[model samples]
Every structure is written in C-alpha cells, then in structure tokens.
Target: MAKITFIEHNGTEHVVEVANGLTVMEAARDNNVPGIEADCGGACACSTCHVYLHPDWVEKVPAKDAMEEDMLDFAYQPDEVRSRLTCQIKVTDDLDGLIVQLPEKQI
Candidate 1:
C-alpha cells in the first residue's frame, strides 16, 4: 500500500494507505479526504482533482501529457510547476509516501 498525505488549504492533513494501482483521486475519494472533488471520476477530463505535489515527489511522477496539461490550464488554482490532476496520478509501491497539497478551491 502507498501511504498518501493530503494537506488541505487550511493546513488540516488527511492520510490514507492506498492500494497500489489505484489513482490518487480514487484513494482520496475512497478515504474521504476533502478537497479532491474528483468530479470526472478518474477520467482525467476534469481539473476538479487538482493537487500540488511536494517538490521532492514531483520527479517521481510521470510527465503530464498534452491533454492533461490542457485540462490543468483550466484549474482554479494554477501552478505551472506543481499543479496536477490527481485523477491522472496512479499509486505505486515506489510512491509509498506521496505527499500532495490541495488547492483552496477546485472549481
């Protein structure tokens, strides 16, 4: 299982042990971690699951595709370097301690 820590805008943190192969959005939704609306499920069509990965963990994740990059452009809280759609992030054994921070709003 990968242990994920989701830090909310207000500094509250929620942590969960997510199963490998599951998307970060799925893990957040399943564990009731706030700030990850996952409005489009895990389809990567919506930017509602936007998150900011910790700087150290950024290089560990795969590069974002053009489509995902486009969707992120519509994110309410955009950060060119750290913003990401959580629905596109798959949990893996190597990501055991992934840490992500949620934006103030997803809309």
Candidate 2:
C-alpha cells in the first residue's frame, strides 16, 4: 500500500493509505478528500480529478501520457510541468509518499 497526501486549494490535507493497483483518484475519492470530484469515475475522459504534483514529487511518479496531457487542457489552471490527472496515476510502492495539490476548481 501507498500513503498519499491530497491537499485542497485552501490547504486542508487528507492523507490516506491505498492498496496497489488503484489509481490516485480512487484513493482521494475513497478517503473523501475534498476537491477531487472524480466526475469521470477514474476514467481519463474528464479532468475533474486534476491535481498538481508537489514540487518534490514532480519527477518521481510516472510521466503523463498523451491522453492525460490532452485531458489536462480541460482542467482548472493547469500547469504544463506539474498538472496531472489523478485517475491516470496508479498506486504503487514507489508512490508510498506521493503528494498532490488540488486546483481551486475543476473545469
């Protein structure tokens, strides 16, 4: 399992342990971490689960795919270097201490 931290726009933090094979979005949704609407239910079809990786974690997680990059365009205030769709990021031992910041809103 991995312990992921989800920080809301206002700085509220929710840290939860998630089993491997689940996506970061699922972790947030299951733990009721506000700001991650996950409207698409972990599908890459929407950007509601968008988040910005903490600076220290920018290069640790798996790189975003073409579809995820494309979908980010629909997120709120997306950052070219830090923005990512949580649904596209799967949980793993390597992401045991992953941290992400939620946007002010989802688009």
Q: How many Å off is the CA of 82 in candidate 1?
A: 0.5
C-alpha lDDT score of every prediction, in listed order: 0.91, 0.93
C-alpha TM-score for every candidate: 0.97, 0.97
Whole-model lDDT, model 2:
0.93
For model 1, the local distance difference test gives: 0.91
Q: Model 1: runs farther than 4 Å from truth? A: none
Q: In candidate 1, what are the lDDT values of residues 6-51, reduced to their tens digit? A: 9999999998999989999999999999888988887888899999
Q: TM-score: which candidate is best?
A: 2
Candidate 1, residue 55: how far the Cα is off, in Å? 1.0
